[model samples]
Target: MKDFPSCFGENGVQIADSSSSSSSSSSSISKAAQNLVTCVYQCKLRGRLSFIVLTWTKHLMGQGLSLQIQNSTSQSLCKVDIKPWLFSKKKGSKIFEIESSKMEIHWDLTNAKFGCGPEPEEGFFVAVVFDRELIFFVGDSPSEKIAAVSAAAAVFVARREHVFGKKLYSAKAQFSEKGETHNVSIECDTSGGLKEPSLVIRIDSKTAMQIKRLKWKFRGNDTIVVDGIPVQVMWDVHNWLFGNSAMSSAVFMFQTHKSSGSHSQSSVLNSSSSSSSSSSSYCQQQIKDSKLQGLDFSLILYAWRNE
Candidate 1:
């Protein structure tokens, strides 16, 4: 497995290849693995920059959750894992000592409602308190019992999720912090031999981008406008077309690029014909470098094809 720092580089964007062995193995896991989602949030702990990672997983037995607090250097300050079968431990709190400061984590999942994914769709809250002050919290609604305290809000930095489908894969994404969540779908027909394979991406059911010759452009980047903001859409589908196993998956990344404009879009589209290796590296560098400027949001989707 890739280290947390390497997966989420200095800019808070994932840097590994989507089609690598690590990604493939992760995608090939059991059906329960499809319920996994990892989200990274940036916030302040004791006035110092830190990250809070929440990983949600689902198993045959039940839903599982893990939380980790890391400093600017990606060093773990505190880690908590909630076992899936521990139904009685749904509502609880834990305290940890970090550099002489006390950090408290409280969670209430007894009334949590879950959808197809492991993450609760509503009716739950996870709160983090540092030095007796509320630092971060996430959920549909906060309980009246947990007092509301004023503090710096956490920034949603990045999310990595696994999606499964045969020809159409869909997920929800928000390009900006305050942006509206939109339905993002990817469609490609590689099953039939009669017609040439092509790729199509849609936002809110409208076609945002399309690639005519997917075989030649299996791994490339394109610029698509979302919420009037320029987003760089990079995809790697080499495994879908040529992998030996049916479980191989394709990887897609949707990133908001504040610096990208209309002029650069045409240039990037023209350069899509470059070799896959160079194109993949160039796209990775583009995201890695963009993160240094504090890009708000990035979404990585591993689309697994079901046989």
Candidate 2:
């Protein structure tokens, strides 16, 4: 066994090639071994293998739905195609059903540029099935992760409320280090639609998972009070270390025309309504010395399931 380079794990095993064999055979074995390692690592990190077992043994045993990391990176991901396999295995069987209205992708970025540019400096992609509305995040970092998670959770809660025909009033969001928690207050109507329901999402500083930073943009017909005119506006949310410390703003205002025939003047406003408790000195240092740029990077994300 010593002659066989071995790597053992609770989940699987890896056997490396041995040079004490015929030259041609050894080369082939070495290549095969390397490929196996790559495949195994990808499967472990993407969580596909674990999900497959859970689907089959869910009722017979006790196990939290968890994924093992064989290898992880920003560009590539591989795992057991559980959903498709389940479909294939369940052909002609009416015993089980899975229901979800939407699927989404989330990216976890380890290193990024986040520089002043028209496009995101760097990020990753993630895909998952949810209760409603397919969502996708372009960047992956602590802040981006928090935003994506919060959005997913909120969308789920909103879908549930919609089912009972509740009247929702408003939706607001907050974040923390603990995790993304949402508080939605709705008037249960038993009817099929809502009149006035409100949702407030809170993200703590703790459960950011493995994200390191985040940034986002909101575009649409959003207006806010500025001086006296109701100015059209957009927002940006930036966070690092998850929601532990962050900055958010809806300060950008549309600039109205000043020339003849134009009635309103508008311009974008950037408010520094930061959520970070740290002083300005710390923020400056963070911006200057951030480590999210310049790295030979690879990340594999389970951007989609078999289904």
Candidate 3:
């Protein structure tokens, strides 16, 4: 079946709308650790985000883990200070800020849903593209949590369709130790099973993201540039978001945009287009996925200010 791209195949996701809250009991690393242990038991019972503190010894402490979030609100949101609950000394804890208007922060420390298996070596990353700017952030994460993050990133990338139209921007995930720069690409395709749409993503050019059924747009052999980068993408509409009998292919493109002054160069290749009958099948699939998923996973509906 066309599965969710392993990385970020399409750009949108159906997230359970959650509220925002904080936890700050304050004791020490031990307290945080105990809290981390206790909080896992409470995840399914609570709504909104939660935090858990981890400790090394009965006295010494480490830090607090909080749920990461991406706020697409039009208002300029500021960084929240949860350091007081995490550190004993004024400078004990540090708050890292993601520069993008849409950013991700550590959400929690427990992996209750995925079950515990050596902690899963998780790190959190969020990718956001605004206008000409694209930014992604990485923090210590576990495998289970990373899966959640990958799911979120796929949703974020899918939303680009509504903003840019025809899958204008794609999103990818990255990982790091000391927090530095990295290069990643978001790929969207629809050439697999005929049941559910999957999302696939790639990490550091190796791992494939789990994404399915993107709004396929450009046929392979199309080259585009974005933020000075070059990307060659292939698109399949019959399997993206619209469904099998729709009128359009779920548009799937890479991060880079078509180089300026190069439209004439691609005129011939661009001239060949899919027929209305082909689009009909694709649109049917897109609608089917939307009905099953129950969210506007189709980026086309939300990419612009007025979609």
Q: Which candidate gets the maximum TM-score versus the true structure?
A: 1
What tens digits encode model 2's per-residue C-alpha lDDT throughout 60-159? Answer: 1211111112221222222222122222321111111122222222233234333321123455322332333222223344443334453422111000
Kindly give the stretch of ten consecutive residues in candidate 1 with the minimal lDDT sum: 1-10
- Model 1 over residues 8-122: C-alpha lDDT tens digits? 5353423222234444453445354477788888887767778888888887778888888887777788988897884548888899998798888889898899987889988
How high is each candidate's TM-score? 0.86, 0.17, 0.21
Q: 1-307 in candidate 3: lDDT tens per residue?
A: 1121211122321221111012322122112222221000001001222111111111123332232332322122223332324443321122344353333333333321222211223433222222222222223543443343423212123222111223232332212112333444344433446655333434355543333323332222233332333333334444334443322224343332223333212311121454343532443344343333322112221111001
lDDT of each: 0.74, 0.22, 0.28
- Ranking of all predicted structures according to TM-score, beginning with the best and ending with the worst: 1, 3, 2
The parts of candidate 3 lying over 4 Å away from their true place are: 7-218, 239-251, 255-307
Q: Rank the candidates by lDDT, best first.
A: 1, 3, 2
Give the lDDT of residue 228 in candidate 3. 33
Model 2 segments beyond 4 Å from truth? 1-26, 35-101, 105-123, 127-129, 132-146, 149-307
* Clashing residue pairs, backbone N/CA/C < 3 A, model 1: none
